[model samples]
Target: MQLAVNMLLKCSESNLIERIVWLDDQYCYVVNINEASFPYQLTLEEVIESLQNETKVIVEQDPFVISVEDHELTEAELSKREFAWAIIQSIYVIPAIFDSKLRAQLIKEASEDFGVTKKTVRQYLKRYWARGMTKNSLLPDYMNCGKTISQEKSFTKKPGRPTIYDSAIKRAPVTEEWKKIFRGALEKHYFIKSKPSLKYAYQQMLKESFSKKDFQSGVKVLDLDNAIPTFDQFYYWYRKWYKADYVVRKREGQREYLKNYRAIIGSATEDAKSIGVFAIDATIGDIYLVSTLDKNNVVGRPTIYLIVDIFSRAIVGVSVTLMNMSGESVRVALANCFDNKQAFCKRVLNMDIGEGDWPMHYIPHTILADRGSELISDSLTSLTENLNIKLSNIGPYRPELKGICESYFGILQQHLAPFLPGAVQKDFNKRGGKDYRKLAVLNIQQYTQILVRCIIYYNHRYLEGYPLSKAMIEQNVFPTPIEIFKWGLSRGNGRLIQLSSEQIRSNVLPTGDATVTAKGIRFAGLYYSSKQALKENWFSQARIKGSYKIKIQYDPQDVSVIYLRHDRRNYEVCHLVEYQSMYKNVTLEEVRLLQLNRNQQQADFEHVELNYQIQLAQEIEAIVQQAKAEDDSSLPKDIKAIRHNRKMEKELLINSKYEPNNEPPVFHITPIQKNKLSLFQAKQKEALDDDYQT
Candidate 1:
């Protein structure tokens, strides 16, 4: 019953009155919301009387009401909002705003100021008062202006302009019969597997629907000059009847529609409550890399595995290796993800990282991956199952399901790769083109460091067009991956799973069988030993019981250590033995390569060794023949005489001292020193001679 600005009153079902301003205690200025009219003075008593009699009611809603923060203002709405505000801004404070003469003068002044008619100013003022007196109230009524062609209208001639070239030509109205023909032709020709163009479809429709059969040739000819609708008319009806989705599906097939044309119903972050879902994928880096062992050796493109937190779009984990994309590589990347980021950056990269520079280092609750052989392997299954982590594989060829991870790959390969050395250019495969592989400079380790730097930058980079939640917007959270990640950790359920590095490795590392022999525990043709193995006397047992296989987990990236899995979460760490030290700090792949080279070298040397042995045997046979020819058999024929002669030869050989070139003795034989002076020294000595001379 009380009058206030923007207050709504329903005088009837069709009439809505908005109170603009109070003229006095008994009267107030009001405006009709639906029609273009100036503000009119209405008595307060009339509204109160209507309310008392139940003839009018208060309306709470204004149809034109909108929140500026929520709705995007179009250019039309912006122009109107500014125009209305400009007009009302000057006259809204006037004391005699409701006075007819004063209102007319102010309207005239506003019209001149804005280069609009006086009626336009009055209409804008009325709208401002009627629709809650807000800037949005002046927004253009676009919904009312452009109407959908949902219902057909009857036309006498045509509902559009005449032909530009031939206005005098008569055209028939599009009737129900023509509409039926249009639908049939569109479905049969346009919306089909062939997906013929609109013009082609129209020509086909004319040929089939409005053609005459020739008697002699029995060929149907199209009616080009008359009797059929125009392509524009046919297209209009087709658009109205067949929606974009149906058209795409029928023309392009269901798979194409689902993959490319389907509407996005929700966001990747919709179900992500925290750091729970991480999407992992692999790509062959566009740039070729050199070998970590020898820089001159081109290692081809490195297989890069990236783990991204879907909710925050942060690059949580990255792995660059010369190994192929397989379950082992995925495991190594996952292990790195679960390891302490600070220690990893320092130990492997030898680079210092500040606090929160690359803070993502926890295992996510669920991992989303593509249907790669590596991801769907039994090894990955066992690893995730043992660690209580969920693994999900997306449908084949559906990259949009894991869009954030794929987007990062595109950014890296397409956007960032062009600037790097040895990057695969588009024309590299063309005939007589330069080979980009020869330009390789960075090794796997150096490339990984560069990737780390890029990832750190990506994490902290401010995101544009990010879909922030209402609560996050209210809290004024920055739209950066790192900031969003931090916010999610604090605001969400904090589902990131934290575990010891050993526990993660025990489950995630690749597993193989190692034989326990008398000498050592052997794996990959190399020896390993652990304190636990020694304490359990495994080697001694193996010696007694013969060698046996024991299941162990190892890092393919480094062959120095392997884990003996005692149970699900327990492991005994083993290291390479002293004799196997040559394989230390080398990958399993490298070890295999070295073993192959060693085998080839030995094979090459085997023939040479055999030739030397054969020559030595021939020489021995020749010596025996020469001894038989020069035999002294008659000298010692009896057994006792031969034995006596052998003893004499042995004694002579022991007593003889051989010297070369009659020079100083090769063997310096010193006489044994006597405890006291010898008799010869007493008879003649240098010291006695010196005393005599003195």
Candidate 2:
């Protein structure tokens, strides 16, 4: 029966239970556990038959069947401890059967076999019965029988003789009167100095110990005859108590201690959801780039503006330009973040990207940036207010607050920048052997494309130590930035607030004040008025303090056209004047540089014009003199005629102007001047004829 129960328990443990089809009569049927066809059938009759056969075998091999002589020899071969333990185990196996005689017999047998006394065996048996009859109950409790003391008593301090310091002090104790003397000495000779040394303080203390009167007050004082402590004792005690205090006093008004010793507390962004917080920062890229328009012109290192999502540490947007860090770069990067990046990737790089490749295209709830002039502008403030985004400017020197973006910059320099030509090596000495500037090959457009690809790879690549979502944790998988972003959105925890392209342009673009004139709207020394802006008499409005100055938003990369904010909800596109086509493709920086050049040229023109005006005045005066000579009756006819000709030449020179066609204008000289010129010619011809006749 026990063997059958064991067999059934084993089958149940292995999940091999089958249904019992029939429980009575000649046979009992059982089906497979999983209802699958089985090769052999299991039944209760077979189990009963197997149990009967096992019972017969157990009876045949029973211990009672063994001879008494053999059992006794086996018992005698056991060791003393083994025999003792066996007796203890036997007494507890069936305590009811172990009567007085039985117990005595067991004790006698243990004593005879193991040499243990009957009295000890009896005691062991008594202990086993009194306790739970376990193996541990039969063992001795050595803790109570040993000489070990309690932990608390052993750890307690024992009273002993006085310490060495106490003995030294007993030999020559420092009295209160002696301490007063030391204080007086310190105040007079040590504390009064700019920086007092301990040795000098000790000497002063010794001197004051023998002084009769105080320095400030001429009064007699008690002298320390021989009770003064030795300099060694004084110095030891001073260091133990007053040394730190003195150092602190001497170091007062110094902030270096605070800076070096203070602990810095940091903040975290893990609690924020995707798109809840963003950190925007700019850095000069380590690699140099050539201009796309002119290869010879090294545009220098481009400033890369990066916007990172604080939660997933994902790069939301990036913009690289030869231009310096400004509000325009910030605007462009943020616009890319808030607008669809798929279209941008396609339009700019002509790369087909899936939806999950770069899922970030939403405005963040809050933005954190350094206190740069470009970031802290009125335009950013206005845009943030309009978009309902909270803008926080971290204090200067607190790069840790925006550590995510700062770390990303380092990662870019270490990982991506090194692969490109003209990449500035981190160590200056490394570049001594090679000129990195000369190695530059990529133009601005190619660099931008590479940057885009790098950003995409960073987003998709697996980042170690990335926090896992609940589902990912169960699956034992680490998530990447894209995974986190997607999981966060699926959980409905992300604030995926998207903005249209027009809305992003209107909000993220930098704004400037423009005055609308009759011809057009003049902004940045360029006109940008369209037919729509001109219609409705927008420029003819009253010239209040800022009434005529309309608010205009523009893309700094393209200055040819700007958007005029007609109202809170509307914007009008304004283009540059037709004559100002030179500025059509110019950037804001280029426009500024152009304006500077124009100002310099204007100054040069003014200088040249001043001298030309003075010379023209002199020429006009000479012409007037020549005209007066022509009318004078006292002057000779030839002289008058020559003067008249000079006047006519001057008039023609003043009247004619250079033309693009390079054709000289036909000048009609006055009738009087022409007759004077013809008479002069005829007199020359008559003189020639008279000379021939002579």
Candidate 3:
């Protein structure tokens, strides 16, 4: 190997040698780059012998010796390099410059000629030789010239430039205590929910903590003009503690930051290289819907859940219901993704479709969604883990992360919803606007059918400017979603997984707590029964021991059957009870809605029921008042005598009504006879019809 200049040689584990300058075939110059050492001559033969014996190894070239471009140099740097080069131009070529005595004399003379000190001239020569003897190495070290913030000296008074507008008002010093105050004020006033402007917050801080109340023009005013830590001082510390991005997130909220302020850098296709990646989201439909039971009863806007394949931009799943965007809706939508498309389209839309028209019934490898309760739930997490699918929840309020699914809602609203009756307008909340809710004419089922047809049209609609892959372009594939999907499968690019309905339900269904009641297994206000429950006598045990809670997994779309989970693998299928057969095909949302409507109707009759109860109480009070007004003075006061008189009166009244044979006997109570009964007399009279009933 050729021994080049600036090559680092490791003679041992600790010591390093840099070949600085070449002298001759017999002698070469080297220096210890790690430590300060004088340049010395070494024998080329010795270095060669060390290399051959594996004693010294060439590690790498020194980084500082790399050539610098002329354009990279500043004017001042270029001038300095030229000046230093001129001073050492003649003496560096001579061999005598290597001698200590000769080098010192030459450097002294050059320093005098250049009007620089000998020490400065010697430093320039050392830098040049150490940096592979390049002219660029003599440039000034301007990179390390400025003093950093840490290197700045502490100040007694206010730092930075003096104010131009107010010279008399001396700015306050920002002490350690003031910094603590600033932090507390910022967190309390600026970063709080009522998000105030920074300037306003500063003024409020001064008024609340720093200033005293004073009267000005007969009005109470806060004397903040002479307060310690001026706005400038407070603002300086604010910038030090919070960055612009953090300030926006803190004051405006994280949702606002995600919606507007955050950066949009990546595409949905960045990680979705094939059709196995799906994006799922839900939105409230713009059009209001009525109840399927009664079209006159306006239910509300329907929640529409959609799952889109990121690779082909095709919607694979859809669920429309008069429910909120919740876990139930998400589960229903996800279950729909695995349903046979041919049957689903015919059953729901009432329109038959060929297999090629809407062909998507595969479990996705990854499901991307927002941090909704639907996706971030424990049941969903367990389902994804069991199914070997990755559940990715994007940041909160970041709909842009799953743009394909979010944009589909807008497409539906723009294309289908606006033309429908009861569709909401943007200015509906404005003054004197017509109530869009009153115009609702379609029910949930009707609206869902219309939505399904629109989805079918969207799938077949040709994409004009889709970003097709190289293989797709070469294959001359049509830009429609179905065509793109077929093309991807043909090239073996988009691999998908197919699963049976039973398998999918076992892994993907959401679970809840169901009670084993004496009536039956009660879940979502419906009753269910199973042969296993009967064999195990669960209901009898529940009746004897009182009802208890059990874990169960059920599909929200259909309440006809539910799975009783014993473990991960074992699940007992339970059918709806015979008594609850009316609600056999009802959804969990529909059941809850029916319960809510019944509750409202009960509430409507509450006032009339309360009035009836009040009238009954008033009648009882009137009768009690009339009885108290009667002649009770003529009756006996003694307990024994009163009981005897009442029994005689009852018998007399009974005899007069039944026999009518003799005149009814009249009994009068005498005051002298109203004496208490003696114990012996009471015992004696107990045998002869002395039984008194109160």
Candidate 4:
């Protein structure tokens, strides 16, 4: 039958008069709340008034019902049975639970509900829970009845036959003599081993007195025939004393279920082993990295959204921003994935799941993830479905299903965040750890590149799995996340390729401080030096299109490195400094030095030669005048030597004869030599020369 409040009482207190104090129309009493005293002698009107006042809460009631055919125990009987159940539960111990704490919690709840102090609640608890409490008060004098009351009547059970027994070991008013004995047992048997309840020890000692011995003196024996417990019974006393300290009582069945179920929970996340199986998940956290530039920390300690390729275990796209993550963020991250294909073996499993403008090869075959509405949003799913992706779920609240990304997030928290520049998660964004490391400043794009670089580093450079057997160094393996993605990527479409010969190559400018330097363009915040590239303008005149050395910076905001510059156009490349130097066959400084080293005196010698020639021509004019004046001495010594040599040349020319193998010899030169020697002829020429000079 339902109680007046329409209820079956569960977890309520006991007692018949306390259980059903209301009379229904059938003249049967029942309870809706805490039962009042039966008060059967009161007049009906007085009872009605009393009940009215009781509803105001000076007194309240609990629910109770009576059954015409009953199988459950009576209130009193049920309480007794529950007490036994509690006692059994208390003694049954298990691992993984702190006993005392559980007990304390139950005690606290019960005490508050019953409007009792913790001590009272615990006393009730220990009445059945603490060991040796139930078997107390067997002997007539065991309960101190002889000293405090009539021993025979007070200590005896019905008909004077003893049913329970715990004998007093000694008799005194709160005596200290037995304290030493109890203390010794506590030190050796209880306190020395674990937390000892002084109350439990007292009860244990009293129980021992009833069961084993009462006094050390041979004359004294604890009579078991009419035994009963007294305050002196150590076992009962200890239970009463430390009643509040008992451990909690858990249902045996509940514990068994838990033990077996834990394994099932662990297995829930395991996935099928098949090719093209991939799990995609996003992780938002702070990343740590050595900046490409100063090797300092860069890329803010800001929140980064990383989409890890489950197949390759590679982080294909990272969008780290100062802002919160959104659908657009996911799209951007996916968009950035194509650029990092070589670095990551992970590809999103794309099926007939037709998606956005995404290249077909980049699509995933199966996207395994949770059903978080974010993943199922039309924007996301439409793309997945369009790309022919077969979607599987890890189930809600089960992150371990996509464990690679989860583990990746964990690794980020432990290994990377701490090493990052600035106050990592707290103030990393403001300080720009990644940006500071590479560019000495934060430009959202470049900083993110730094973070991506960190991932690449983790994959290729980090040591993972087991330590090496032969070498002192560990085996460096790709990050497992990247490995997973790569495995997926390798299994996917083979039709996708880089630029082909049939297609005209569109060159992309080096981004960031990515200007063509003697070094290659900056990417992911790192400036990669390339030998083939000319300084600053390599992209502009790129006759042959090729992937330029990309200076990488992990973009904390997103997966794609910003490649520093905002523009996509190519810039003309200047000659690399090496080429200029090699072509000139000299250093620029050497050329300048040689030009500056000329002597002024050597240069003046050319003027000296020209002046000498002019003076000689004038001297020849003066010689003609001198001959008219008959002054031969005016000419300088060297010139007179040169004239004498010339005069000798004319005489030789006039007198020389040709001799050959033939018989002919020249004989005509004799007349001129003869005329030169003749004094009369010399006198005639001198007269003629004087006339001409005049």
Shift in Å, residue 164, candidate 3: 74
lDDT of 3 by residue, 102-159 (tens): 9888888888888999887877777776654545557666644763344435578888
* Rank by TM-score (best first): 1, 3, 2, 4
In the order shown, the candidates' Cα RMSDs to the true structure are 29.7, 32.6, 23.2, 37.6
Local accuracy by lDDT, each model:
0.73, 0.61, 0.72, 0.39
Q: Candidate 3, after superposition: displacement of residue 38 in Å? A: 69
For candidate 1, list the clashing residue pairs, or say none.
Answer: none
- Candidate 3 is scored at a TM of 0.49
Candidate 4 TM-score, C-alpha based: 0.26
Query: Mind giving the per-residue lDDT tens digits that candidate 1 earns over 172-202?
Result: 7799988888888777878878778988888
| Ranking of models by lDDT | 1, 3, 2, 4
lDDT of 4 by residue, 1-694 (tens): 1122111222224332222222322332223233321112223344345445542112222111111101222334445445544443443332111246765676676666656677755444343222111211011112223333333233222232343654443233223444455555554555433545656655565555435544666443455564333443455434533323121112123333233321121122233432234455565454333322223333333445555544345554554544344454554455444343332222211112112112212333455656554554445544443233456655557887678767776675566445444323554447544433333333333444445556665555443662222311233324444443333333222111121110101111111224443344433222333334434456454434543433322222222223221221222222223423222211122222233333444686879989999999999999988787985553334453587668766666655544334344334546865765595567768877998999
Per-prediction TM-score: 0.50, 0.45, 0.49, 0.26
lDDT comparison, 1 vs 3, better candidate: 1
Please count the clashing residue pairs in each candidate, in the order shown: 0, 0, 0, 118
